[model samples]
Target: MTAHLSRRSLLGLVGAGAGAYLLSGCSGDDESSDPNAPQTINWWHIQNTEPMLPVWAAMAQEYRTAHSNVTIEIQPLENEAFKTKLTTATQAGSPPDLFQSWGGGVLRQQVDAGLVKDLTDDVQPWIGSLLPAALQPYTIDGRIYGIPFDVGMVGFWYNKDLFAKAGVTETPTTWAGVLDTVRKIKAAGIVPIALAGKDKWPAHNYWAYLAMRIGGLSALQQAAETKNFDTPDFVAAGERLKELVDLQPFQRGFLGAEYGSPDGQAATMGNGGAAMELMGQWAPSVQASSSTSKKGIGDKLGFFPFPVVDGGKGAGSEAFGGGNGFAIGKDAPASTVDFLASLLTVDNQRKAAQTGAVLPTVREAASGISDPNNKIVAENLASATGFQLYLDQAYPPAVGQQVNDSVAELIAGTKSPAQIVKDITTVAKSQ
Candidate 1:
């Protein structure tokens, strides 16, 4: 979940610097003793997974072995912490040699400030093999700036056990059916859906997906960029969410819920207090990380793309979510960039897929992975007529925060659909 930190807080975290940033996967290998060897390259990433770490570790080790001169220091900062650290490091002129970013506004800021290297020339050969949308977020004007890695979609996850108990056998495929199913699940004494509202970020996704399924992708893109949020199309999307809020599909007091910790709606799902969760393909990883919960959950968990709205303008199967990628800093050594480029090779992507549950941006590397969940997500993403980057990633940070806060208020009953549309428009125009 993305948290809105004050600029001061972000600055403080970033200023904490080397001690905080160097702890992720830094090793004590002393291969730097050779005076003629190239300098060590530091990589700042936010990935810390029990199952996925080994793949990255081996990748780094292999790169080092091949380059001999480039010793890459892989630092794994917590997601939120990484953002703060990155902001500070860049400001201090001590940023990592390469960094992992969602690569829209975040990287754009770095590019605008002349901190990131333009990789248009470097990334071209691999660009042809990537899905076009995966490259959209990282592209500025006409130049490519990052190497695509993990690509996935966001959708709905339901509890098969809860559905069975509610006497619902088939997954609903229409907007009205979604409401009816949630009502039935609630009547069976469970929270119809788990919402991480306090996190604000997850709640923001509700709007993104709603715009996709109800207002259509074009409408979503318009609201994402301009003061056009008050359009009939956008208001219609906001109304759908308002109807859900009135029906109580979300848990009681959900607006007060926290995420990225034990107190979130994800916890509620794990404990069976909720019947469904609306999240990305990464939901499986969350379940997999908890041993007891994983065993107890069994095959009861199921996933489906967001339901289509009757007569909606959008294609039903088009999905919304962003992927991760590797970006090079302006000061990165030539060898460091080469090593990072190799990690995106088909062979390494397939290997990474085995440890990490990522869908390779390259079609060939994706074919090498046999994980069922990965296959389902990859197929859905590939088949999607269009894809929406994460809502926050699609807009400027200030506008994204306003949208997030607006959604939280909408869910909390403090704002009306019309008001939200008006408010978002006012915010967009100011930016």
Candidate 2:
């Protein structure tokens, strides 16, 4: 339960609506003012694979061509490696000129240490071009700190063919309905869900979504603020998840399953070995990559928002997820901000969206999405009633890791729901 913001409140933060904004401010006119200014922008990002890796490189080359005096040095690292390297760099007080950022608790820590620049004034002129919800993660204390390139939410990525076989004629819109669907799918000899239990973060999503649905969007935030997750709503969230676990809907050896392995959650779902998975915008691409055919069950794939719980304080429209963005280091060249702006242009964003690898943050770039699933996700995010960043990202890293550990224990049948909540509460208090 990250801090929640209503759509109207988010819109107000941008001053103007997204449709009215333009990318005029992002052009390198300031660099042009001083033609011979030699500035090398050091950019570190995590899109180290195709088609995004090459796409990003091309964008950097294009930028360099436009501003002859500026050289953009791109360091594309793998996810874990990037985190490790960035942590080392930041700790040594030499953060990259511009690097990948997810925003929320981590970004907050960076801000506290004065490792990142405040982009509020620099980006305000064109910030509105991005969907308001997309900016929620990058914003701290109502101040903008990063520029988002992609945004999305978590939801059910299901197999329509499997549902049909299970006689589930309609998508479930309530928690009870979801259970019924799962039971039916199990009865039909299909694995109801694909879970990467070995990867604790994946299991954490279920408990987090349950909390959001039961305790409302602000529940996690309230718990974090008070360092108390032992409330009735949090307990109920665990109990409800327990009900799902008791059904044994996941695949064989699910507790040890990885996410992208050949026999993991994505592969299981991609190969049609499991009926559904709860994941973010990147699900389809990963599924395809992990499948035996190296091509997922394409048309059979479908998506739906997580179901609502009876008598819950939360609505069906509150979204839970995060996105990719770039944060500027404290001493980055002035032109670094401009270069970031250039990367988020409608044209560049549209190119990224075309790869089906990202949900473009720029409103105008959304039209470039040709995939129906991506379109559905984008539309759902656009109309989301409330926005919450992923719990692992929204809270301190220690607390977040505790959440993943506690939830994994609950799923493994070793810890009671009440006990898990108490464990999480203890970690939050320590944080």
Candidate 3:
């Protein structure tokens, strides 16, 4: 069930009908030099951090100024709550004008439910301009549906200073090596890794990271789309996960820690209470903004690709990620659509990237970024052959809830891998 979109074929479509318009027949008020000409777009997103909150607010203000008639009413929601409200709103036929979405299971489910708009025409001409990894999830059954805003990879983020203290000369490149490295780090009196299991999604991500290494990218996709947990491929992934858990690689009380924000937990690394963390590329942003900003530890951060699981079928470079993007709602006015399209243009996307958000969606924009770490992350995301969407976003909301519960149980040693897989498969099969 893997979907394919070759660069050449996508380029040909762009050339043949590049001028077709999705904005046609859409109308808005004609007034002064205003981009916001009285259009009200209810935009829902969960960006509640000092760095990003102000950044997005400023962007919204700029957007409103350009379109005098348009105003994006920002509705901030918690991650778990947002999903619930989104479902209720769509079911009630009164969803927001534009909402934030992470491509993968969530976007797929929304599109399948007819809760989102298709942007095939608007996306065609700019199709080739995007990196392959940034475009795949938006396409379903050969139709493009949304635009990417932030695209990033999951990786190992380590503290160079901590590594030095532990007497580790180099980062590990294989799962076996990582385990050995973890043992040494712990024996040296430092937390090997910091994990926030309270956030179910991060817990699931740990499993997905291991699954991709255990089953390979294609096999993971097959199991997901086909709901075939009986395959030895997926079973092996579960076993590997159990093995990692058996090692007790995480900090004490990690199973109950919250992860949606970096506020309180990042102090572990800020104070050298922990050595490293395996998370999205955006993780550095948290460390950079930590209480130790005055201590200069931010500059000492290092990143590595997720370690390969030895003897596994997966590629060493394979990654798991989700693209954050904008989508037009069914009721959005034509002018609003125009503003959205223009906002995501190369120039604006470049600013977004520079301002600390990932922007691989627009190659021209990504090229302008000066941050070396971000640049490396952006490049890896671009060259990615395939992506594993965030598990919560990929499955039905109920199934996602089950996944969270399963991971919690597994981590708590209350549920066996076989039982967890069976529980998830039972619900996944229904979907």
Candidate 4:
């Protein structure tokens, strides 16, 4: 109960300033009691792409300069690769000292398995400086398990020039309008969307947003609790996504495309080969890094909230996404937390924000976000009426993967709308 915000109120303090909501909990030996000690911190993160990759390295080097006692070994892995490797590592009961964490069901499972470090005492003193809203995802059962550095929601990252060329005058605000927009864009001989089907997870955003719009935030919570996703709402969400899929909206050979590959989703958008892609805050930076010119589409990139679904229970104001954080592993030296704290400092947060690739979790660094696209996302997130962490990060790993698998098959035309729900439900029930 100390976490304060449950899954239902993840964004309760988004626009408000509040004290840190993480309260006291059971304890472990205070590893951070020592001021200086020779230690090697093993860090694994998924900001392997440029812009962020260099930014993270710079931060580590800065930390090292401040404390010569630490030798930090860094590994920047690709998203899918990080997930696969992390799973294997955790199963083997060996987790990196500091590793990237999305902080929801996965963190909870880690906590339950005693694989994660209890950071309640380690983080509370300085946690108040960060956004209370951002902390909710990392808090489980009255203890702090991780600390978020970036927070944002999923939305459409579109190429304005392509939209204009397609003669779509405005961004769609309804599901029907989005379909119409796609049709128009496609007819104009432009790929309506740049999708990374080989990655599977990118395609899942469409279905997740659709379900959020049609079923409401409560429906997702209910399904998670009941382990049943066969409801009419979910089925309709799938069918609606199918309507867009059948329009042949994505780039050619999209099903075989990778997300950060040279010819993949971000690059396609950056190269002006597509009108849009559903993604989170980092889209623009990734686009720039993956693009041929390494400058991306620059100001041509724009963002919009996922469109509303008419007659659906969810409001357009609700957001679906998650942010990035670092969790300490069970056996990490106490200096690990001190090092983590150093990275989350307001000055460091401001530094990260100025790169325009991150949305600051520490309130003081909010002014550092100068990228207009990121600002748009930040404003929308601040005013979000509700929030849903990405489902893959919200549910148990197995259940979450099932959602990605089933939705990807639906997008690939290998699974029916009804069958995808049945399959997801089967996995959920088993879990």
Candidate 5:
């Protein structure tokens, strides 16, 4: 699910639990502080929903049953609220023992401030079990600071029936091919694409993915590092997107459309009103729920990776995405690492995958993925050579929102290719 930063918000029941202390603290060396001292781990995560929330509670209950000398306190918060509360807590130097982290500039700042634990050595033995792409964001300067539970990517979700109707016999493999397919679909009396202009985030993907395909991963990293996005590669990315926009491919009133509403982007694709949407791993489920029939396109739905640019430096296997992860706080008890180990075990990862809420970070748990579409994504993600975290999550909030807004304007014909990049550059430099 995308917005690793924005997939969900659901309430969960509270559970009280005791704990047993046996694991040693992984890092830091204050002589007087004992590694195995009895302690209560204050845990926080954003899986504030039925299957995950309860799964977490049961795991804590298991720890409580292990011994009488420890305690396990859990706090499950909705996504936005968790971010808000975490900001306040970290500002005060009291982050929970373990908590949700999307890992980027935010987590890097935490590490710089001594608020996060260094898990480089602690997770070494088991960390190799996770997909390297999933761990990319959590590894800072060659050291691990966080652990991923789930990972996913964005791709084009298309209706196979519509593609057949439009005579697109094969999925497009290049940007030019994508344009030709759109033309074919449109000429066949079908709306070629469904976009959520009102939401902005969905539109942001177009420009971002185009930038990736045209300029390669280093282009994005350089833009962030240099506080500039007005490079020729970025400009060409926007120009490429403008080509698509000029095709008049979107549904009427697309500028005002939402993403998951009954008459929005997902519904347009789900109901076969439009051919496809460039979205995240969560698209299919949301499409089903938003459709009038509540069954969506069903077996007619198929996904393809974003097409490559004809003369681009980027590899087709490079992807744009993000996922949910957990970071340890500097002062967390010794046993906290053990507790986390329990949560990420192969058995536990499989259980999480079974619930259909996550794509487990561990490879062995893949068989538990019941959703066929999710299985496809998980398969593709494993072979990905490089991954760019969702732009909104990778950049600071203001810069991220500016990319979303500027790109939306680009699609609306209110901003030019050069203008959007410059606009984003201004915000990035200011930040």
Candidate 6:
């Protein structure tokens, strides 16, 4: 339905720019008038791995072939490295022409600093081609600032064989049922959950989802606006998490586990060392790649949305996850915007989806998905009644990091649920 909207209707949703930046070789004027202008667009993205790495490179080459005078520079960096480099560049007032952005409070900070472009008018023509729900992460204060290439939600990726071995009949739909499932799996001599505790982010997912389920989707946004996380709902969320921790559900030495390493979370799940994991759409591919067999546990894998909590405010249909996208830097050439639009064409998006590396943001490109697990995630995301971006990406850097720290402490039994909320509130208010 979103793919058929007219440009006029889409343009009505665009918001005005907040401010302007003055940079050498950059102008607010339209440069499309000069068709032969030599332009080079600098792009930094995190698809440094095999499938997506080559896919993005091929797309750039195709674009270059069509426009002889234009040059597209691509720098593929690992996730953490990309974030560090981008931070330094932004602080130095020299951001890449186009760079990877998750688009939430961080983008809002950049927008306020006038380091990014206002793409309201530039993208309106084809913006409607993307699923409107996928656009929420990029829409800041009613204005668009980024273009999403992929979208998905967090859920349970489990081994069907392992479940049956544990005599678990149904996938869980409530908190109590999830605990029961974990207990059964542990009794069957299988680690219940594979978590990348050393990474901190993976462990934080549990607390974030619990908060969403207990307080409702709006709770985080309300806390962000008021700079207060010290509340009954938030503490209750942590308490619920503590109940899971009490079962010792994670793999042995999980606190030191990495996400993609041979002995880490995905590999553990892929090699059938663990019964399940709570992860995003990319989990399956990562699992396969990290496993010793390099083929993962193919048909043994299954997916289900995060289970609900009885008497909680959140619904089963609300989702919590974020995807990858590109943000326009302030000094980028005018042609940079056009290049970004070109990258999102249905054909290009389909190629990305075919790799099983991404869940396409373009509505029509959804058909390109070859894996059933990914298809299930896409369908659930499409039907979601509410959505929330990853908390680390949705909040300021300091506030986000504080959340990870506090939650980690809570998981380690070093802090109480109430203390964790207080720690988070102290950091959040300072931000």
* Total backbone collisions, model 2: 1
Quantify all predictions' global Cα lDDT against the true fold: 0.70, 0.82, 0.66, 0.84, 0.80, 0.82
The TM-score obtained by model 6 is 0.90
Candidate 5: tens digits of C-alpha lDDT, residues 1-431 = 01112222121111111222222222223322354455677788866644466667777777656744446767677554576688899999999888988787778778888999999999888988988878878888999999998888889999999999989999999999999999999999999999978878889898999999999999999988998999999999999999999999999999998775567787788888999899877677667656778677889999999999999999999989888889999988777787788889898888888765578899888878998888888778878888899787788767887998999999999999999999999999997
**Candidate 3, poorest ten consecutive residues by summed lDDT:** 7-16
> Given candidate 6, what's the lDDT at residue 275?
94
* Candidate scoring better on TM-score of 1 and 5: 1
lDDT of 3 by residue, 1-431 (tens): 11121111010101011111111122443423344345556676655443444555566666666655565666645555566777888888766777767766767776777777888875566667776667677777877767777788878778888898989999999988888888888888888887777766667777777778878887766767787665666566667777778878787778766553333345455555678877776665555544454231556878788888888878877778676776666666555556567657787777767755454477777765666667777767667666777777666666777877887788778888778878878887987
Per-residue lDDT of model 4, residues 302-363, tens digit only: 99999999999999999999899999999887678988999899888988888777899999
Which residue pairs show backbone clashes in model 4? none
Steric clash count of candidate 5: 2
Tens digit of per-residue lDDT, candidate 1, span 183-245: 898888878998878767777777778788777788877766565788877677778888888
- Once fitted onto the true fold, the runs of candidate 1 whose alpha carbons sit more than 4 angstroms away are 1-37, 90-95, 251-253, 294-296
Tens-digit lDDT string for candidate 6 (1-431): 01111111000011111111112232224334354576777888776654566677778777777876666767766565677788899999889989999898888888988999989888999999998877887888889999999988899999999999999989999999999999999999989999878767777888999999999988998999999999998999999999999999999998887776668888899899999999888888778766788778999999999989999999989999988899999988767888899889999999999988789899889889999888889889878999999998999978887898888888888999999999999998888
- Give the runs in model 3 whose Cα sits over 4 Å from its true position: 1-37, 123-128, 260-264, 290-296
Best by TM-score: 4
Which residue segments of model 5 deviate by more than 4 Å?
1-96, 251-264, 271-273, 289-295, 331-335, 396-398
Residue 288 shift from truth in candidate 3, angstroms:
2.6
3 or 6: which has the higher lDDT?
6
Model 5 TM-score, 2 decimals: 0.80
Poorest 10 consecutive residues by lDDT, candidate 2: 7-16
Local error of candidate 5 at residue 234 (angstroms): 0.5
Q: Give candidate 2 misplaced runs (Cα > 4 Å).
A: 1-38, 68-71
Task: Give the alpha carbon lDDT tens digit for every residue of 193-237 in model 2.
Answer: 999898777788899999999999889889878999999999999
For candidate 1, what is the total of clashing residue pairs? 1
- Candidate 1 residue 115 Cα shift, in angstroms, is 2.2
Pick out the ten consecutive residues of candidate 4 with the lowest summed lDDT. 6-15
CA RMSD per model (angstroms): 5.8, 8.7, 9.4, 8.7, 6.5, 8.4
Clash count, one per candidate: 1, 1, 17, 0, 2, 0
